[model samples]
Target: MSTAPLLSVDWTDHVTGRRGHLVVDRLVRGVASGGLRMREGCTAEEVAGLARGMTMKEALHYDPRNRYVPLGGAKGGIDCDPRSAEAYGVLVRYLRAMRPFVERFWTTGEDLGLTQDLVDRAAAEAGLVSSIQAVYPLLDDEEEARRRLADAFAVEVDGIGLDELVGGCGVAEAALTALDRAGVPYAGTRVSVQGLGTMGGATARFLDRAGLRVVAVADVKGSIVNPDGLDVEALLAARDAHGTVDRSVLRPGDREEGPDAWLSADAEVLVPAAVSYAIDTEAQERIRARWIVEAANMPVLAEAEERLTARGVVVLPDVVVNSGTNAWWWWTLFGDVEAEADQAFAQVRGAMRALVGRILDRSEAAGVTPRAAAHALVEERLPEIAERYGWY
Candidate 1:
């Protein structure tokens, strides 16, 4: 409901010719956290939108009734291709310029075009610590498992990369929850994912493992489809470093080329996990899926959302669907990780399932779209919190 951003900054690297924006929607508990994305044609407005979504996500997750975690929403973007040779230098310069902000108020992790390794290196070069890393204990061997006990707390610390699994698992669980709310069976359900990057690939793999058929997956290069369901593991293994699935690795009959092939795939669930505004009005017309799980931020346009709602399609908002990383951060910092890494993942999944189910149920009860219900839930508390803290 708010049209203005809390904080927005644009910066450029004179030497590397890099430019970017940082937008913080709100500061909760004196801190705001989100991811730094690098992609061609990214804009400050887009970054601001993502930052706002983060605020909504955190507000809902940490609501007094839910009490999942306490965080605020923010996002940063660099308008450059990470594949370019100058990317490293650009990232370093960006980090250096934003060092003060990163340390004082905003903490960012990896997003679309950026990798966790790149973010870690950039943060190191900037002499700043990642927010998530700050909470984790320093381990010379990430693979070694160590258990520690306190007066009332015991936890196991392992080097396993739990953050890597959070987003995908969250998305998959949200989708499953939506299906259950709609009384749709997961078994034999077809899914089409509109990106094969970290979030998208992980979503596809998780859904496939959960007995949903991932019938199609798309990357920037193109799409590949098989009604019988693509080999999720094989496709993952065949993906290049850039996350593009090699067409050669697919069966000869599975390959398909079209700007909108993935969007039109015959499936029950469609996940737009690659880019923003993937399902505009025109694209929405081509959507055959009953459910649209937004794995990417703001993938559905407002008009498209309205249209989809009128058509009885359930559009899960990105804020709720992609809260896995946020939940993972909260759990790593506060929850008991004494069990295996999978236990942490299970916790996140269960949380997402409950949240999604509650939102969908509220929407149906109110005769409103799921997005409206989600926004209402967040807005109900955000204004009061903002007023109480004099943030408005």
Candidate 2:
């Protein structure tokens, strides 16, 4: 069977007379949600691809066994530079004009080159809410991070930390799923997380508190390894704006290495929590862990995943593994947190469990890789949607 065709898009703002693109790559039977990124050189195809990812992500979360097709994931992008204030105003106007799409069909969330402030402004102009802020906690520049810790913790039994602070709900769920599949107890499992950005930092804090060994962590500036276990509390205390670990403050003999070294470290699990397509074909050959969890969106490429599966590595795909943030966004849109913590966590947890089960079952039955199993699952479910709609 042929692959699904890309959604047709109209790339222009009817109100501003500016060029923008609407890529509706997939359709949920009812509603579709995804991020809308604005950047220079953003193309219709890029938005479509991202939308396609969201469709698969939503599907994996909603129906892990591929029993139901993925709900529609749609992403929109405006091709413009972000350096000028004029561009921001134009973007706001563009978003306002796209309110119809936002309200009924697609939901807008933050992505690369977009900030919470920008998201809030655009959302306000369009009379919509920011998905990233809704799902993930928003620490306004004016809000004290330490002061909000209590409020964040009050929401759940577990006290809020850097995990909830940076908000890697997706990566956290992914790590939990990986541990389940490996039969490795979450407590005391050795983990090495690369890229100490929002996702990595959040996942590290959660895993560390949950009893996992965060032996090594890295960021754009540098990498650090502490096989004996690093003091997360001190690290969090000294963390810089970009969540960089201050090397000067380390308590002696804390080995520092280049970023690439983390991938080769010995551990039960490895999470590439940075950005899309970090684990490509070349990097796949260096991976030495039993389980790989993708915390970032599209962190592992298809070709690389295939290679790793050939080597007996069990990989959890980004679609399901990194969907906590997306689920949280949906929850906030449809439910309230104060009244629905159980419901929210259940939806996220259930999705993680179902996706893991489906992958394991399919892999064992066919003697195939988990990545392949997930691919097969998504493929089988895609066509059924068109059938239900009786596409012409």
Per-residue CA lDDT of model 1 for 203-256, tens digit only, reads 888899899998888887888888888898888878765678877778755767
Model 1, position 14, has a per-residue lDDT of 97
Q: TM-scores of all models?
A: 0.89, 0.74
lDDT of 2 by residue, 267-386 (tens): 778988765667899988888888888776677788988888878788877766766766554433333222244655565566666667777789889988766677787777666655
- Window of ten residues with lowest summed lDDT in model 2: 133-142
Error of model 2, residue 361, in angstroms: 1.6
Model 1: lowest-lDDT 10 consecutive positions:
144-153
Give the top-scoring candidate (lDDT): 1
* Model 1 clashes, total count: 1
For model 2, what is the error of residue 227's alpha carbon versus the real structure, in angstroms, after optimal superposition?
A: 1.9
